[model samples]
Target chain A: MDIQKVTVAGGGVLGSQIALQSAYKGFDVTIWLRSEGSIERAKPKLERLRGIYKSTLEALKTDPSAWCRGLTDSADVPAEKIDELIARVDAAADSIKLTCSYDEAFGEADLVIEAIAEVLSEKEAFYAEACPHMAERAIVCTNSSTLLPSAIVGYTDRPGKFLALHFANNIWKNNTAEVMGQPATSASAYQAVVAFARAIGMIPLELKKEQPGYLLNSMLVPFLNAAEALLANDVADVETIDKAWMLGTGAPLGPFRILDIVGLSTAYNIVAASPDAANPDTTAGKIAAKLKSYIDAGKTGVNAGEGFYKYR
Target chain B: MDIQKVTVAGGGVLGSQIALQSAYKGFDVTIWLRSEGSIERAKPKLERLRGIYKSTLEALKTDPSAWCRGLTDSADVPAEKIDELIARVDAAADSIKLTCSYDEAFGEADLVIEAIAEVLSEKEAFYAEACPHMAERAIVCTNSSTLLPSAIVGYTDRPGKFLALHFANNIWKNNTAEVMGQPATSASAYQAVVAFARAIGMIPLELKKEQPGYLLNSMLVPFLNAAEALLANDVADVETIDKAWMLGTGAPLGPFRILDIVGLSTAYNIVAASPDAANPDTTAGKIAAKLKSYIDAGKTGVNAGEGFYKYR
Candidate 1:
């Protein structure tokens, strides 16, 4: 009943991270790509992940500041054991396998983690096809940012095994996994997922009930929304707003800086999802427009390297 | 004319700090207390402040953590300089004259900072009595937390000289001065106050328009409200909420911890002020009731050393 073999469907940013991170934590991970196009996209992503792990290991030896980078340390990794970590990552790389075929990927999966594109239809379609191919005891967990676990649980074969296993973007460094069960999900299934999250070196936060944005985003979004309102309403410029926040509260990063990291496209989508609050004068609409302008210019985020403030 | 003689009305926590800080920066300070009873309260407060300044000076020479305890810097000061800082505090204590008489306190004041109780009627009565005692051309500023600068400007003989000059609780380390002028506030009055703030070693943020909570609180209050809502609605516990925030975003402190520092009575009064949203099911009502119950038990905040979390 232990989750030894983990299959992560979707080889995008979070999916590749989940797959590589699972493998890095000693689980045999298979990343299922939708097609040759996605596989092509995933190759560079997986390669970049390798680079990230290498730099993270190197950073641990010299710079204390290096630890909080996207995919690295929360707890102190003793300097003496740095080589062991590098070796672990190397071994974990060996455990990860990528495939375009669902049958090959999900055949022996102890857990099928869906981290596909966020559209509900895409999720439902993928789940319908992938569920039948999953191993008999395989638990299904979706990494949907906005959609509830119940929204896609009906698409899966085992209702009792379906749940949400959410991760913050920088999986290696910001290692938080929020686990919540759909109404039909069994208590054992929830606990198993929680244990799996812990197995993969994540601090699992169990949400007792279903919350739309979960604990983190529910708190985070309003802050960002307020910041955006300040910017769009011309209350303050971006830099001033950032300075005020940094000075007032000793936060390491400002809201816009975080928005740049979170990706403007993703931010826009989140804003766009809430259409009821879309008047130009309203905060949500203004945020959407601001993000859309950046997105239109191909300045999506750190990946594209130009969001609120330009990145080199 | 240079702001040489500064008078701070009221000998409360912030008022005493303002007077002490102004004196530390070499401005002759006069503190106006209400009565002999308050003079007793002010005695221990002033004595404690002197002790704080001395320890802060001594701590600068050794520990790096002493900087933010209502004083600035983590740099190593030579033992000679530490003694000089202590001497300066003693000299500053010499420069600070205390009186219950408004006439004696304001006779030759260049700048008068009102840091009295928050109640508007209390402010109006104080201003009505004290305005006639002020030296001609002495700029007046109210350190009202939530009240508009316009609310009490009418009571001042020189409405053009009156404005809002708000400071955060721990004035020395958190050296921010939010200067906002009411409609009748003169441009020269605003500039002079800005210069005066700089003289006292403060970074003065000039708000072009009056914002009720000004810049910091406007951004901060919503974040706190959201956190309180989460706590009240049974979404998450305090520690988990704080952990999620700290881990998700690299903020130095969380909302509940901040509430603890801000004190529960102040927070309760803030929530209670908006009486329209008092339904039990609403987030605002839940927060109000939660704060009320805690305050009822006299578990007010860090001053009592037991708020959201017990402190030693």
Candidate 2:
């Protein structure tokens, strides 16, 4: 049950990071895409990620505290040693194959991490196609941010082999992998994924029960929603709310600043999914309306240079 | 309306801090207590706070970043200068007088802060009796944690002058004051309170509209609730949940640690106030049940040296 050959089923943001991180950890990684267009987008993303890793490795070579705990005992490690590790990651990157054919992608995958669109039908189709070609021993895991594993577990041919292996945005630094299993999932399958998560440099938080949004988002979203409610209710303006949070909690960034980093549109999508989104009186509806105005104005988030506040 | 004389109508934990801070700011401060027993309890709390201020000043001298922002330019300023400031604080401490007589406490008072019990009846009774004795131009403010300004504004004779001016714990350092006015509160009243907050070294977050729980608690309570829910559902252990939060958000302390600092009983009282406290199905009820078990065991919080975690 040693998961070495990993197949990532999407090459978008979280998917790309997961793929790059897996390769960097010396796993024989393959990225599966629906079309050549996705592969085209993924190429530049991979290159950009490589550049980021190079700079991060360089920073780790100098200051260990630059990125929290920098690559472990980074201070004692020589520049040549860090460069060598960077070269190893590059070598691992070379071994990764981009495939459009499901059979080719799932050929030797010990683990297939489904990172496709969050849409139910889309995930079902991806799993249906993937299940037919996947190895008999290969465990499948969904990289869903919000959707439950039970929703997709039924679509997979082997329900006991399917589970959720969620990862945070920054795979390299904030290396948190939340492993959630459906009721039918085998303990062996869950353990293998947990082991794989650790192998790829992530602290695995194994949930005994299935939870929508898992641990991080379950706690974080409510906090963000509360901040948005204050704005929508007109209790205080954005600056006052942010300043109050910063001054009160001694936190450098407030919820609004975090929303800017998350991209308001993505945050809006999560809120919009709930049944309460339709009611304007509800906090979700108010948040959606505020986000819609920003999204409509082309102020989506930090990437767009503005959201709740200006980035630059 | 130049406010000079200040009468704090309570000798509780927050009231003691408020009176001490006001005196430190050179206000002619008076603490009106219900009984001599209450004054005795407040005396030790004030001494401990003075000790905290001195040690904090010393830390600022050695390490500027020890506690967010240091008091003045402590590095360049000699230890003698810090000693002089401490002596000045001690001198201000002399100005704070304890009184059992409301007439004596409120005499020549330009501002009267009602920091009495959270119970509506007690607050109303105190306000109903103190109104006739209050100065014609004096402002009345409540230091309520959860209750809205609109709820108690009607109890005062001058609704236009009544408001809520809330402060966070540890007034000397984490000096956040939330200024919330009722629907009937005058613009001048709100402005005067905001100015007063600044004069006492507090960063005032003036709310144009009344909000229950205000800014800090509005955001904090939901976070604590989420953590409690995770524990109640048995998704993960306490340490695991806390570790997940800290590692994911880079937050210094998790919700459980914060509960310990707030005192579990205080946190319990907040949850118990909700109608859901009777039901085990809801998060509020679940939190109350968990907290009650600890409370029944006489493990209140940090004050009792035990809560979610035992303190030395």
Candidate 3:
């Protein structure tokens, strides 16, 4: 199926990016917000993204490394053609429509990307409200980082078309879209979503089964947890762990540095939820305690200016 | 304690690198081999490393990105100074002394790096033979990847001076040296080892306690294990898993590629050793079985020309 009209549910960080990137790719895009306040908040985010996209495209003209895969075809675009692409960025930015009504957003959408809150009940209610308005052929994909599609597929009207299309942050640069489908999801719908991911200039990673955390977080969380365990167990300090990973694997950042970017609260909640964290003496419990101390002290993460390491 | 005369026990892959890198930094270096055959085998490896170092230095002269942090001061070296650096590489390669006698290698040595077989009995036997000849002031460090310093400190004469200084592969570029100390190890001795690691152009990651797998593998192994579990559980294929990680994290290589480089046998051994592998229904057991099938087909890793992916 040719996906032209795309409706993105919610106008948050990931949702705004999804809507903007879809429009940037020449898709007729609309962002479905919950309220006027959400629309007001989302407009500035879209504007900021527009400025970022313009500057990034400008950088690509002179520097080859500035080429964002999702924004352009390749790094070797002729200098003259770059101007056209930059114009397209502005055109795409201005083209996106915003609506608070479920009928207006999903009535004719070829694809409805649910990028709302991670709360289960919130997603269920949003799906139920939006389901009646969506087109019969429209495929719905949840852009959930942690929750599984199978758990929520029952709530959606078109279970056969419901799956997942998870994206990494900064979609234009780190252009990976993980397409996962539940057992009930139809093969045609899965293929269509994979093709749609490719149309948006993403490397689509297809998962055969529903895996929690998908592919990226499945690997990342365990790695971060191990590093946190080391710190809580007093095997090494923060800098030592970061330096070891960076110098050893040639990775740009270490676990703690990544945690700083990912936010300590996120790490704290994940650890606190683990069964092992119930006991204070366990490694998970100790990690939770450690993160709580940091969070309580206002050293939440890089966003707060400090976490494992101080950031200016 | 100032270290000058350095002895590297064994002439294996990492042992040769440690000896060469130390010699390159102008230390008086000796490599002790177990037999005449071992000396003959090590000569070619040193010759190969010399070629690599020369070409790498030559590359650094023209391309700033080619500057190996472990080999040179910085990428901004004057073009005229490169010839001198190249000359030093040749000189360092030619200066290394090789011997089979434990007394000849350990006598008057300021530091001894045990880089022999990973087997416990072999390491214990080596330390027993070399301890009598080692100088009273000499600090003994095991370059063991998996074994803890505390586990082998009892074999050495100087328990207070014993520690672990593990180096990553391709030490010229990946120049991380993890320094871990046991409770019996003196603070001064640990500090000396850290300084010595820096003197050899290594970033010393100091671990306060002896952690199995040190800093790198402690985090790396768990990350790889999670990826393996994903594949074993049939959630995703090898390439899908690799692509998700590489794109999502902006890492150069994915877990399977790293596993291929790390060798399937090593991964299999590590997995099979886990207590969970006793049950075939467990993820660890499935991963071990999958790795074993690949190993049985002679697809060991990149070295064997095939594993999860093929290399030219």
Candidate 4:
């Protein structure tokens, strides 16, 4: 119940957002990276996001430095920037530490969030490394959008302490999150996770039972399934489908615009995660099939300049 | 195509909104009612809505009297009000007429709009009765959210001129409309409908083909389907679900609130028209079953002062 040090395993977009938001809430965060390159690539994005977070804090008339817990770049960020990152982390948290070794990661963390590649094996291996070293009461949460909580916790020794915690992007602005608790998860652990989410200004919906993608994606996947088919069949043009629903439903963006934001490659994974029965006859398979082609062709949305639709 | 007179069949909430909006667009429209009581019941509501429309016009800095084409009350509204209604209608359109007979309803009309009951038989009957009286180049459009476009137009003499012209509610402020063309509908017919929609200050989405509920409802039904099921199973309180989605997705209201606004009776009709397999096994069946009980017990929402949730 004495939640203190927290670690985010992986430096992906979601991992970074979770880390940033958690740190903003005054939790000392160490972002563990699998490789030096990920740490380096994630640094600029993290700094840029922090800058945006600063402006957000200003708008809300809150002081960002007041909650500056700490950030540990671990294996990825440039060694030269480590001191500055650690200084910010220290300002946010009472203490901060960084190390390239997995042992150092488990040694100092009270809550470890695994947010690596969504591959089952990759995440399973990461969980195995932390199970023995993490404190008995330390909560371990995943930022997995498509994986079941049972599947991820199955590899851990203290399975009762592991759960899934999803955060909406640009964590500082969007305040929604989903927390999935497995059958073996302790009530205290779920409450701790919820407490941590609340401490960070997140409105978390706790699932009574864990399902793949939990609730948000569970409700949304079927919609995307039909939309992709609609696009493939040329039933309606992209802009029309996008603008129609955007205006009609008051969704911030049309489905395709959202698909672009989530990345075509990521969208393919979500679509593939959905059972075929959810969409049997439609050729929305083109969404995934074409995504792999587009990614292979080096065309990923705003990041790569092209996906389902072009972005500047 | 020479656009002249129009007949709007039905005198319900949606039908009235459509009639009011169409009248505001400078059309001499005769709204056909099902029974004498309906016309009587609609009189005060129509006057109140006209007052709302008048304020809406003032808010937009326009003349209300000059914009109204007509306010014809069917059998329920007395023939004594005919001259006053005709005068209001004539201020906006070239002329206006009121009648109680279905046999003479579509005579000399350039366009016939079916906004009657969602019941297939009821709509089919209207199509059969009205089609013969429509002018040669006249367009037939339905403000149907549930029924298939082809099925309704199938009973018409000129299916090639049939389309679904859907307008959002609160039409005085919201100007989005969906134009769905049936399989047999001619290109010119679709174009003419689109032209009419545009002339009325609506931003039209010309769907390539007719889909059930057209574009907006096709995307929306599933969301409501999921939300309704969640409410039925007590997965979450109705208010929370409404708040979660409305605040989360930025919808004006959650599914339940929308259902209330749309009327439980109408919501039940829409659900019945939807493919049942698309909804949650437990929750999807609840709305219709609940309504059947409610209607039989005379407890429909707003009209009955109670539904899934009560309204003041």
Which predicted model would earn the best DockQ? Answer: 3
lDDT of 3 by residue, A1-312 (tens): 878999999999999999989898889999999999999999999999999998998998889999899988889988778888889889998999999998899999999999999999999999989999998999999999888999999999998999999998889888999999988999999999999999888889999999999999999999999999999999999988988887767778889999998999999999999999988899999999989999999998999999988887
lDDT, candidate 1, A136-196, per-residue tens: 7999999998899988888888989999999987688888899988889899989999999
**lDDT tens per residue, model 2, B121-180:** 998898888888877899999999867878887888899999999988778777889999
CA-lDDT, candidates in order: 0.84, 0.84, 0.92, 0.68
Q: Would you give the TM-score of chain B in model 1?
A: 0.92
Candidate 1, residue B20: how far the Cα is off, in Å: 0.8
* Candidate 2 segments whose C-alpha is farther than 4 A from its true place: A63-65, A68-76, A274-276, A279-283, B63-77
Error of 2 at B109 (Å): 1.1
**CA deviation > 4 Å runs, candidate 4:** A33-49, A55-90, A93-96, A272-299, A306-310, B33-42, B58-96, B101-104, B229-252, B263-311
**Which is the winner by lDDT between candidate 2 and candidate 3?**
3
DockQ, per-model, please? 0.58, 0.73, 0.76, 0.32
DockQ, model 2, C-alpha based: 0.73
Query: In every candidate, what fraction of the native interface contacts is reproduced?
Result: 0.48, 0.72, 0.86, 0.28
Query: Candidate 1, residues B153-175: lDDT per residue as tens digits?
Result: 87789988999999887788888
Error of 4 at B70 (Å): 16
Best-to-worst TM-score order: 2, 3, 1, 4
Q: In candidate 2 chain B, what residue range of length 10 has the lowest lDDT sum?
A: B66-75
